[model samples]
Target chain A: MSAVVSLSNVHKSFGAVQVLRGVSFEVGPGEVVAVIGASGSGKSTALRCINALETVDSGEITVCGHKVHDPALDRRALRRDVGIVFQSYNLFPHLTVAQNIMLAPTCVKDMGKAEARKLAESVLARVGLSEKADNYPEQLSGGQQQRVAIARSLAMQPKLMLFDEVTSALDPQLTGEVLRVMEDLARGGMSMILVTHEMAFARKVASKVIFMHQGKVWETGPGAMLDDPQTQELREFLHNGL
Target chain B: MSYQFDFSALLPYWPVFLQGVWLTLKLSALATVFGFVVGTLCAIARADGPPWLKTVVAIYVETIRNTPLLVQIFLVYFGFASLGLKVTANTAAVAALVVNVGAYTCEIVRAGLESIHKSQLEAAECLGLTRTQTYWHVIVRPAIERVYPALTSQYVLLMLASSITSQISAEELTAVANRIQSDTFRSFETYIVTGALYIVLSFVVRAAFTLFGLVIFPRRRKLGTAI
Candidate 1:
């Protein structure tokens, strides 16, 4: 099976600190890959590089056929195929939930207003937020807002989604709400790469699990590999995270 | 000295005072609209334009902000004369006021643009919004909305400062008041009346701003809270 996303020996640094040191990974079509790591492990940086949010210092990243590492890469084209949701749930405060989802379709794709509104409605319904379409981001709870964020990304019909610590800011119950929505997407066979601290969610929903440490992919295997970690680093990480 | 105050002495010049008020309003309206447009463009340039453009906007903002409005008006009015141009005082006045207020509006708006979090911009980028679309929809529109109150305050001060153009002999409120005071010799009563009219004008302007805000920013109106 062909991979939808691939990275080979990607290197990135911030000033003097090297964040991603020769990291590599791949996500096949319909693969749900969970990247579990401690803080400062460069997992977020790798995910950001996939979306071209941060350029790789040295190496190759290809996402949905776009050569992300190329200097003349069409960034907007790359973005059209990839959707990203941040931990902050960065919804435009001035727009309603429906408008937030409709923005890109109308502006980038030039969809008609009625069509965009219908698309927004369907996506909001997917996240079970149909009633809150007219509500502003501030009016919703943290969980509802994150679901709306998911729906906003879904409006673009992106082939791949990137979730960067999306549940980190939420309480256990709110996190459960967001995780449930993500699990639904995974069950529906959407390709996703998520950086998470939730060991249990990663274990249940992820087809493959990767453990990143010291700016590299330290260990990778099926979800069951987490229970039988070969590296002492993964063992200690699972121990402390529990 | 017990001086008798007669406000009624200035009542005969009501028609003149009304015309002055109307002219002042027109000057302020034109300046406010053009100044805001210029300020918004300048704000966007300073924030993301090329280095040369940013430097040009910076110098303009600094130059106008540091100089006196009176002197700026004089320079604009007489500067055209020196160039052997036949510009009227009112034209010079509007040009000077727009230039002056545009600089201040640029600074106020740039602050609003900066206050937006980087994450918001990242989201816009992820959605594949072009630079113009991103700036208009996510950056400038919201930034201007955020700083609307400050912009309103600046515009009110601009209207008051329009009185300074009277020195150039523009036929605005203060100029009309100048003629009234000299002709009636009730300079004391004339100024008192004009000052009261100025107070009324500022209030009306503020009220209009509030109504305009209600129309444009549905989010603020719907939320029933300050943006």
Candidate 2:
């Protein structure tokens, strides 16, 4: 099967500091790939670069068969095919949850408000927040808001979804709720690239798990590699967290 | 010389003063609408335009903000005449107020726009929204909402400052008071009544904005929360 998303030898820098250096990864259709890393490991930057949120200094990133780094590619169209969920649920504060989900569909896809509303309602139901459609982001709990954020992405009907530590900002009880949503998405065969610190969730749901350290992928294998690691850095990092 | 406070003497001129108050309201309403549009556009250009455009907007904002409203009115009225652009005093007053308030509104709006998180822009981009869609949905609406309180206060202050335009003989409230005081020779009493009229007008403006905020931000009302 062809990979749904691919990043080859990507290099990214913010001023004098290099955030991503020679990092490479790929995710096939209907697969969940978790990128495990400590803070500042460039894991989030790599995912952001794939969506063109952060411009890669060099190398290739292809999402849904479109070359992301190429100047000729229509980034807006590419982004429509690949959705990203933020760590801090960045929903529009002034818009209702339903409007938040319907925004891209109506504005970008040229769907009518009625049609977008129908889709938003369905997605909100799918995420188990249909009743909160008229509510604002601040009114919902962190986990509920994150689920709304997920539904907002799904409403666009993206081929691949990027999760950049979606549950990191939540409390433990809330984290479980968000992780459960991701697990449900995975079971429903949504292709996802998750950059997470949730070791347990990574092992349970990810088909492939990657351990990144110091702006590079240090190890890659099945979920079991996290438990039976070949690298000292991964072991030490996991142990320290424990 | 015995000067007793006689509010009854001012009662006869109440109707005339009311008309002047009405004119002041109209002028302020027009100026606020036009000024807000100019301010919002200037802020957008300053924040997102090319470096030269940014510098131009910056200069306009800073120059207007730094100078006094009195000088700005004189410049708009007499300066335009010097350049051979003849206009009425009322038009000059309206134009001056718009220009003056537009600068302050630009700065307030720019601050709100800057407060939007970079992550929000990325999220909007990832949703496949076009630049314009992202701007309208994620940037402009939220920025305007965030700075709305400041905008309303500035507009109220603009209404009070409308009195300043009477210097150009615009026939607004202050001008009417001037005429009434000269006719009645009761300067203090006339001003006292005019000041009360202004207070009532400000309250009306505030109430109108509150209703407008309710209509514009229905999500906040529905959810009973702010973000």
Candidate 3:
């Protein structure tokens, strides 16, 4: 199977501080890649670069067959193929759940209201939020809000999804509900690159694991490699219980 | 000697006073709508447009905000005449009021725009929304909602300030009162009646804004809370 996302020797810097240096990774079709690392380890930056949220200073990054590093690239088309969810959920507080999910398809795809509403219903059902369609984001719990965020992204029918510490802000129980939704997405064969601290979920759901340390890919292999220490950094990171 | 109060003297001109009140409401409504549009566009330009546009909007906002509204009304009324452009007193009044209120509205809206989280823009961008689309759909309404109360208060002040337009003889409420007092030789009673009318007009304006806000921002209605 060919790769859906490919990043080779990607480098990025914000001001004088370099966030990503010579990072390389690939996510194949239907693959779930979990990137585990300490703060400032560049895992999240790498995910952002694939979505072209952060421009790479050097090297190539491609997503869904488009060269994201190319300045002439059709950025809107690339973005349509890539969906990203942040820890804050970022749902439009003024809109109801269905409106939030329907906004992109209607605006970007020019889908009609009836069609968008139908798509919204299916996506909300996928995220287990059918009953909250008319509710605002503030009315829902953190976990339900996150699920609504997930449904909003899923409504776009993206080729690949990026999750940036989506559960970091939630309690353990809330985190489990979000994780379950993500697990269902994985089971449905959606390609995903998740930057996470949930080691056990990564071990269980991630087909390939990339452990980053200090702005580079330090260790990488199957999920089981997390068990055997190919590098001391991965072992210490796992032992430290993040 | 005890002074006798005579509100009876002003009773004959009640129809004239009502006419003035009606004109004031109409003028205030026009100024409020156009001022809000101009101000919202200026806010967007200042917050996200090119550097040149930002500088231009900044100059407009600061110049209007720092100068007195009375001077602005004079400029709009007399400056046009000086330039050999003849405009009616009412047209000049409406133009002056819109411009004056627009500058204040721009600053209030700019604060609202700035308070939007960066992640909101990022999420909209990832959804393939163009900058304009993202702003209209995701950023503008919520920002406006967040600052609706501030906007409403600015407009209330704008309604009160319309009385200043009477100096140019716009035939609005205060101008009508000035005429009535002069004609009837009841300056004290006429002024008192005008003051009461102004108070009533403000309450009507406030109620209209409350109803309008509820319609435009239905989430506030549904949730009974600020978003």
On DockQ, the candidate that comes out on top is 3
Sorted by DockQ (best first), the order is 3, 1, 2
Residue A26 local lDDT, model 1: 92
The docking category that best describes candidate 2 is high
Alpha carbon deviation, residue A76, candidate 1 (Å): 0.6
Instruction: Return the TM-score for each candidate structure.
Output: 0.98, 0.96, 0.98
Q: List, residue by residue over A97-154, the lDDT tens digit for candidate 1.
A: 9999999999999999999999999999999999999999999999999999999999
Stretches > 4 Å off in candidate 2: B6-9, B223-227
Give model 2 RMSD, 1 decimal: 1.8
The clash number for model 3 is 0
DockQ for candidate 1, C-alpha atoms: 0.90
Give the residue spans of candidate 1 off by over 4 A: none
True-vs-predicted CA distance for residue B198, candidate 3, Å: 0.9
Q: Write the per-residue lDDT of candidate 1 for residues B30-148, one digit (tens) a residue.
A: 99999999998999899989999999999999999999999999999989999999999999999999999999999999999998888989999999999888888888778888999
User: For model 3, how does the per-residue alpha-carbon lDDT over A1-242 read when each residue is reduced to its tens digit?
Assistant: 67999999988999999888899889999999999999999988898889988889999988999999999889899989988999999998889999999999999999999999999999999988899999999999999999999999999999999999999999999999999999999999999999999988998999999999989999999888888968988889888974
Between candidates 2 and 3, which one is better according to DockQ? 3
Deviation in angstroms for B106 in model 2? 1.1
Q: What fraction of the correct interface contacts does each predicted structure contain?
A: 0.86, 0.95, 0.95
Candidate 2: Cα lDDT at B191: 94
